[model samples]
Target: MNTPDVAGATGYIDTNFKGKAEKAIQELNDGCDFVYIHFEAPDECGHRRETQNKIRSIELIDELVLPVVIEGLEKFVDYKIMILPDHPTPIKTATHASDAVPYVIYHKNAEIVSGIDSIDEESAKSTNNYVNFGPDIMKKFLGA
Candidate 1:
């Protein structure tokens, strides 16, 4: 197995989603078959119980990062994207929860008719497709 190279910003609020997205795009342009981009602001906000900031952080990711990455992915003939949080950090408890988190696996050329209008905790649960083990999700994402 090939060891993945991990690179990103390190500070709490300084974890720049846009920069990370750009790096991911660059990796793709440089012939990388897979790139993982992680945004930590929302998790940090959840841990600090900053509910509004958490929401805003998620919004920033949607606005400043995902679109850029999606556009970058368009340059490729085939690509798969898997978006998910490692775990849930509820603002009420200001700590990590063992509850399952939502995930989205999108294939570029496949026609999916799942009828799921959105990707979120509730929506993922509504699909009734749960992977009990974490690594299993990676296998599923890679079509292994």
Candidate 2:
């Protein structure tokens, strides 16, 4: 998958994803329990002022990046993958919206969570580990 030229950034999403994936694989091999991979393409496309590009970026991530991450994840005995956008960036406004976007938590052990989509705002908010949105969210995500 190819990413359109993203101005004011050092590299595009696909390139950065490749580099980040390698590091994440190494870290996972070293026995880290959790790993977070953020796909910046959709957000970048929003800033670039194109709805098609943003849509394509999300498709590309699912087609190209996700499979790669899933392969690496299989190396772990048991793992959970949480996929969520930090915030919504409307292509029209080209700015982030303070809204709750749906989050997905995929488990290698499917029995832990429902197979079908059962996760939602209320469930996530009431879960044992409820993380309020903010700068600190990254800290919670990284387990630092």
TM-score of 1: 0.90
Best by TM-score: 1
Per-model C-alpha lDDT, please? 0.84, 0.64
How do the residues 1-144 of candidate 1 rate in per-residue lDDT, one tens digit apiece? 233343556535556677788888888898777887767888999999999989988888889889999999999888899999989999999999989999888898884778899889999999998999988999999992
Each prediction's total of clashing residue pairs, residues at least 3 apart in sequence or on different chains, is: 0, 0
**Model 2, CA-based lDDT:** 0.64
RMSD versus native structure for model 2 = 6.6
Put down candidate 2 lDDT per residue, 3-56, tens digits, no spaces: 233223333444455556655666778766555566677787787777987888
Which residue window of length 10 is worst by lDDT in model 2? Answer: 1-10
**Any residue pairs clashing in model 2, and if so which?**
none
